[model samples]
Target: MEPRWLSQDEQESWLPFAAMLIKLPAALDAQLQRDADITHFEYLVLARLSMIRDRTLRMSELASVVSASLSRLSHVVKRLEQRGWVRRAPCPENGRFTNAILTEAGWEKVVATAPGHVEEVRRLVVDALSESELRQLREISSRVLQRIDPDAGTW
Candidate 1:
């Protein structure tokens, strides 16, 4: 069968979106690295932990929350551990699973880093969009994410 293809209009729309997928992360990561000495993914792991109860999450659950593989998360967690930002141990409730717990230092780092990150995000995205456009952007992203992974909800 002949393949379905994006028409001219669809191609025009897709081009910018595809470029954004690459550029946005790089820009965010660059800001985090410069200001916080952390990569964007590291910030995400810490931020996610900061929001949870006890600042603790099972390793697998943390991976899911961060949209990372367990192996990749483990490596990042290892780096965090070395910086005294995070620690891993057997889950008290279930020794078969490990838990990632944010340390006091990790919490402090998140608190300190968040302002600069938020400012950068606001400068780059939030402040650029009108209220209606912001809502439309959210709706459009949700639809695309649903198509990409039906089980994974929007971030």
Candidate 2:
């Protein structure tokens, strides 16, 4: 079988898109490291946890929300727990399930860290686009994400 190589137009568009995929995470992580002493992924986990009611989520649901593996999130959560930001407990509704609960300190951490993180995000990505462009970017990214993980309903 033969491969379907990209056309020149496709290649041109893909080149920059691929570069963004490579660089964006690093850029965000660097900003987070300098300002918050945490990686962007950690910020995401904490921020997501803070948003939900009760500031808690099932371990599996948290993993899915962050688009990470359970093991990976567990490691991050462990670090957070060590920092007094999060605690884990058996789910009230299901004895076999566990929940990650954000502590008071965790809420404070999120509140403290959010502004700088948001500023960096705006500086790096959001402010670079016009209003219309922002909408288009969301639509386009959603399309690509649909293709990448078609069964992901939450995204």
lDDT (10s digit) by residue, model 1, range 1-155: 99999999999999998999999999999999999999999999999999999999999999998999999999999999999999999987888999999999999999999999999999999999999999999999899889999987745
- Compared with the true structure, all predictions reach lDDT values of 0.96, 0.94
Best by lDDT: 1
Where does candidate 2 stray beyond 4 Å?
Answer: none
53: Cα error in model 2, Å: 0.9
**RMSD values, in order shown:** 1.6, 1.3
* Model 2 lDDT tens row, 33-152: 998899899999999999999999999999998999999999999999999999999987889889999999999999999999899889989999999999999999889899998888
